[model samples]
Target: MKYPILCCISLLGSLTAFTSSATTCPEILSSKQRLLNSTENIELCEAFQGKTLLVVNTASQCGYTSQFEELEELYQTYKDKGFTVIGFPSNDFRQDRGSEEQSAKVCYLDYGVTFPMMARSSLTGSSANPVFTQIQSQAGVKPKWNFYKFLINKQGKVVATFPSSTSPVSSTLKNAIEQQL
Candidate 1:
C-alpha cells in the first residue's frame, strides 16, 4: 500500500543524524542564508537535520494570530517527536507589526512563541527569501497566503501544504506530522 507522504519518516526523540547532523549554514547559504530565531542567518535545510519543520509565514495582525495557541500546543506535543515549528514573521501581506522588533516581540509576549522565530521576512513570489524559495523549489509547493504552513519531513521534502485557514491544531496537519513521526 502507498503510505502517506510523511510516512517515510517516523516520530522519534532526536533529529535524524544520518542525513543532516553535520550540515552547516554556510553550506546551505551558498544558496541562501535563512534568517533564524531573530538574528542568525541560518542554513534551514540543515539546521533541523532529521527533524520535521513546520514553516509558517506569520503576521501579527492577521485573524489567525489565535492559532499561536494551537501552534505552541503542537510544538509541546511533538518536539520530542522529532518535530519543530519555525516561525518566520512576515509583513509581505502588510499585516504584521511593521518592524522586526515589534513582530518578534508580539510573537513572544502575546503568542508565547517559544519556537525559533526569524526577523520579519517575505513569504513568496518574486521577493521570496532564500528559505522560502528553497522550500518551494525543493518541496515543489508555493505559499498561498500569510499563514500558509509547509509540513516538511525529515529529508527536507515538503510533505503537505496546509492553507492559511487551516488551524495549526487541525487533524489534517496533525496527521501529517504524526505520519512523519
Candidate 2:
C-alpha cells in the first residue's frame, strides 16, 4: 500500500518529537500507535485483537534467520489457539534495509515468513522505536540482536522478552507463549 507523504511525515514527526530518553518508548506508541503492518499499513494493534502475539525484531541476513522456519512452525501449531508471530523487519543492526516489498518477497521466499511484517526501522538504543521502547520498559533487557522476541499476551500487555538466540521451536518459548493462552 502506498502511504501519503503526509502519513509518512507524521509518523516520523511523532517519533522524532518523542523526548529522547532511556525510558520513553512506551509513551510514543501509546500516543501514535497506529498499525505499521505491511497489509495496507493497517493499525498493528487493531488488526490483531483477542490474540497472543510473538513480536520479533527480524532481519533477512542474520544467523538466527533460520528461526523463521521454526517461527512458522510455531505459528501453525498454536495459531488456532489465538497465537501469532508478528515480524518487524529492522535495520537497527545494519543487517536488513531491503524495501518492504522486497522484505515481503524474501521473507516468504527465503524464510517462509507467513505472519504479519512491519515496515523497516530501528529497534533499540537512543534511536529506538516506540514499540520497542514499550517492550523494553516492560521486558527489562533489550534485544541483543535480530530475531529477539517479545511475547505479548491476549490483553495487549508485554509478558516476556527473549534473546535473539532463543530458538522459535524451543519448548521454553512455546511454554511461555502457551501459558497465557
Best-performing candidate as measured by TM-score = 1
Colliding pairs, model 1: 10-181, 11-181, 16-50
Which residue ranges in model 2 land beyond 4 Å of their true spot?
1-39, 125-127
Write the residue-wise lDDT of candidate 1 on 1-181 in tens digits.
3565446555332456543445533221234344533446665554576788798888888888778778889999999879999887787777885566677666788878887776666767787766687777776776767778988777667778888999889888999999998
List the global CA lDDT of all models.
0.74, 0.75
The ten-residue window of minimal lDDT in model 2 covers 26-35
- The TM-score, computed over Cα atoms with residue i paired to residue i, of candidate 2 is 0.75
Candidate 1 ranges with C-alpha deviation above 4 Å: 1-38
112-180: candidate 2 lDDT, tens digit per residue = 777766677678778777778888777676777899888887766788888888888899999998898
Window of ten residues with lowest summed lDDT in model 1: 24-33
TM-score of every candidate? 0.77, 0.75
